[model samples]
Each structure stands twice: as C-alpha cells, then as structure tokens.
Target: MLIARWIFDIDTIDGRSAADVQGAAPAVVLDESVRVVPGRDGEALAFDGRAQAVIPAAPQLVLSQVFGFALAFFVNVTAPPDGEWRGLLYKPVGENDARGVGMWLYPDAMRVRGQVFTAKGPDYVDSRTSLRVGEWTHVAFVADADGMYLYIDGRLDVGVPLEHEVVPPYGPIYLGGQPDRPGFTGLLDDLRVYASALDAGTVQALARPPS
Candidate 1:
C-alpha cells in the first residue's frame, strides 16, 4: 500500500510546507534555497545542495518485512570538487548505528546508489552505469525477504543479497537532503513510499510518462 507520497506539484512551498498527497502531515521545508520548478510531470522541488524537507516520523513510515520507494529526479549540475556524497532520501535509525535505508547520488560518478543497514551488516547496490545529466530518471529501491533490488527507469539494474532482515528505521523521512550530509543538487518529484515492495510490472507502469 502507498503510505506517503509527495508530488511537489504546488507552485511554492506555501508557509514552508509541502502537502503529502497521501494525506500525511505536510513536510516542513528546511530553508529558502529550495524552490518549486518544472518537473517531469508537473512541478518538482529543487535542492541546491543546502536545503531539504522533513516528514515527521509516523508509525506507518516504519517498515520491517517489505517496503520500497520511487522518485523522479533530474541532476542540474555535477557535484562540486569537495562534494563527496549527496543524499536523495534518508531514514535513519540512530546517530551511531548502521540501521537505515538510504539512496544517494555519487555526484562525481553521476551514478545512483542505494543501501540498507541490518543487524548483520550493510548491503549496497548501484546503477553501475552513469545517468545522463539534466534528464529526469525514475529510480526505485525495494527491500524484501529475498534481498534488496535497485531499479532504474523501471528496469532492474542490480540486486544485493540481504544478509539479515532489515531493521525498521524509526525516524523522520528526509528528502533532498539530510542534516549532516550534502543536499541533493537536483530536482525531485513524484516521491512515493510503499508498505510493500513493488513488482517489475508495477514499476514499469510508474516509469511511464503521464498521459
């Protein structure tokens, strides 16, 4: 089931808040640097490597058995020389423990990567190939009892075995940036969170352009 969705179709983050289409609490914008601009569908939220939005923690946001998320993103420019990592989506468990699921862009490589942390260890997967700059791409990351899967443009890119089941990260969802990590320097739209992992057919349907 779709738990949380942020379409970012509004012209502005009115009152510093963006509506969650699924009826969740509005996401609070972090700063003024974030802007609403043209997106693959309607409008997208732009992050200039400094701003972000936070969705308060809710019981439904926590997933243990199966879950996944998909988003449309367009990288505006390459990362600065000093940029090491920039977060696209992050939900952490603790400040010191490796217990979270996150997807980020390796700006320098222009590649997308996803990771999941469990009691056993962390599993990682990446697109292996670079994405074209200035173009919107649909990316999805799914975690199930079998393993973790990374899909780009609705196609399976890679999968990594989950040594241990995912430990639900109980925390607020951070979009486009994190408090400690570099913010994503790009446009993000159609962010969706699901309680169940999406299958290949459904993922393909999501990647299709809106009519």
Candidate 2:
C-alpha cells in the first residue's frame, strides 16, 4: 500500500488567530469567521462560530489516523459499506479490508451516538467521562494493521479488532455529519487525517494545541 502526505491548516478564515501552518490538502472554508493564521511556532487555524469543511483524501489513501475535535457540534464521514449496511456513515478502508471505520471521542462524557452496520454485524460505542462541558479534549482512532484503538483526551478508551472486513467503494469522509443526511450541529477545528498508523505519543502530539 502506498501512503500519501496531506496537511490542512485553518488560518485563513476571519476571527481566527493568525498562525503559520500548512493548511489542509483539499479543505473547505464554510463561514467567514474561520481563518488561517501564523502561529507563534507553527501554523494556527482558528474557528469563531459554526462552520463546515471537507478534506478530500488521495485516491489511494487509506485512512489510518484522524485527529481533531468538534468545537461545539460533531464532524462526520461517509464510509461506504458494501453489503448489509449499504448506505451508512462508516469509516474508510482499503481495497482488501471490509471492516467498518472507527472513531473516538474526548472529554470523558461527551455523547457520540451513531449507527454502525457491518457484514459480520452492527454495534454501538458510547461515551464515558467525568469532565464538565466546554473542556478541551482529544480523540483518535488508529485503524489498520493491529485493529481499532479509540483514544479519549489522549488516553486509550477502547480497542477492538476488525469485526468484519470493511470492503468499499468507500465513500468520502464527511465533516459535520453524513453527506445528504442530517448535518452535524457544532464547530470542528484542527481536523487531520493520515495514511499511516500513529502511535500513542504521536497521537497525543497531534492533539495538543500549537505551542
């Protein structure tokens, strides 16, 4: 499998802090509040209010790591399913595997409710945290070689194997809800995707705000 490099820096929108960064490979600027700016050390992108953006993956890019947060609402993706779960919001996969996509939430108690269907079967994963609202948190999913690892606020929350081989005509990754479905109702910031598996430390580093 060939891995491609892509970067998205949110610093061009209005009301956003000016940080020098490499923006998204294929990104969308929703409202006028968000902007890409130069960060003290790196590039910084800021979000002021509700906005939506999508980054197109390389044709052969296999999603392995996703890092970002839904400032107020939630971001979503379209993982085109092959068999039973036909047209649902799923994670992306390579040509060989057919297991569904994986996602992780942060701040401990944030609610993540969605429908996941697979050839093997379908299931649900909920939130578990004790933090108050408005607290900044981080979440990551390492879906590939090993399996699925869900990280909440930089810590491991759940890890499971590929319940089923997630084959595709995989759909595009949607931000803020499944395309054509009910849209997400919140703010998303610092979103990123990688073609390789990111270890715990790497995931943590990506989650941290630019210093």
lDDT of 2 by residue, 98-195 (tens): 32353322222234433233455544454453222344445555555335555566666665665554333243444433333333222244445555
Q: Evaluate model 1: give its TM-score.
A: 0.88
Q: Give the residue spans of candidate 1 off by over 4 A.
A: 11-13, 25-30, 66-83, 94-99
Clashing pairs in 1: none
Query: What is the lDDT, from 0 to 100, of the residue 72 in candidate 1?
Result: 35
Superposition-based RMSD of candidate 1 using all C-alpha atoms, in angstroms: 2.6
Model 1 lDDT tens row, 1-211: 7877778787435667777777864465546777887777788888888788787777777867554433333344334424477788887875444538888878577777888777777778887756666777788888888788877887888887776777777777787768767866777788888888888898888888789
Winning model by lDDT:
1
Point out where model 2 deviates above 4 Å: 1-24, 29-52, 64-109, 113-125, 130-132
Q: Residue 179 in model 1: shift from native, Å?
A: 1.6
Q: What TM-score do all the candidates reach, one by one?
A: 0.88, 0.55
Error of 1 at 184 (Å): 2.0
